[model samples]
Target: MTSRRTFLFKTLPAAGITLALARHVLAADPELAESDPDAMKLAYAADASKVDKTRNPTWATGQRCDTCELFNAPDGGDLGACSLFKGKMVRAAGWCNQYVP
Candidate 1:
């Protein structure tokens, strides 16, 4: 019989490998472009500081993808996945109308 400890030990390596592969795949994804149709709708700015505050009154300085609640990039990653834009990557310093504090 496979003991609980034995099972955990056997699965741990595979789990680590999976995590590593996932990270690599994420890293390989292209960064979301500002001109992307969906990106245009949201007014995504690769650099949050570039957002036109005059037009986007609700926007406050310092709001960025990396700081937003939906930001899902791995720690220290400059670009990563976002829940809002499936299969696409957003810049850590980027911003959009959908930003959530």
Candidate 2:
């Protein structure tokens, strides 16, 4: 018969540990690069400077993956995961044809 205090004490740390591990797992390293075939298919560039503004007139000078709807920045880092390229991280300053603002 564990008391409520004991239950909480045991549960809280385990829950905290699980949450920490989940974050770590979600922050795993990227599996693809801008030069990959799939990335090339989308015309993804690791640096926004490399994007052809003439072709992507809708892309503004300051637009970046960090601001894109598909990006999932990890701890607000400069490099984070993008839904466009699963299991792969993209630079915050990156751009692509698939960018949605």
lDDT of each: 0.88, 0.84
Q: Any runs in candidate 2 off by more than 4 Å, and if so which?
A: 1-27
lDDT of 1 by residue, 59-101 (tens): 8988999889998877668987788888788999999999899
Worst 10-residue lDDT window for candidate 1 reads 73-82
Q: List all candidate RMSDs to the true structure.
A: 7.3, 6.0
Give the local distance difference test score of model 1. Answer: 0.88
Could you give candidate 2's per-residue lDDT for residues 1-101 as a string of tens digits? 99999999989999999999999988788656867998889888888888888877767787788889999886898888888787788888898888887
Best by lDDT: 1
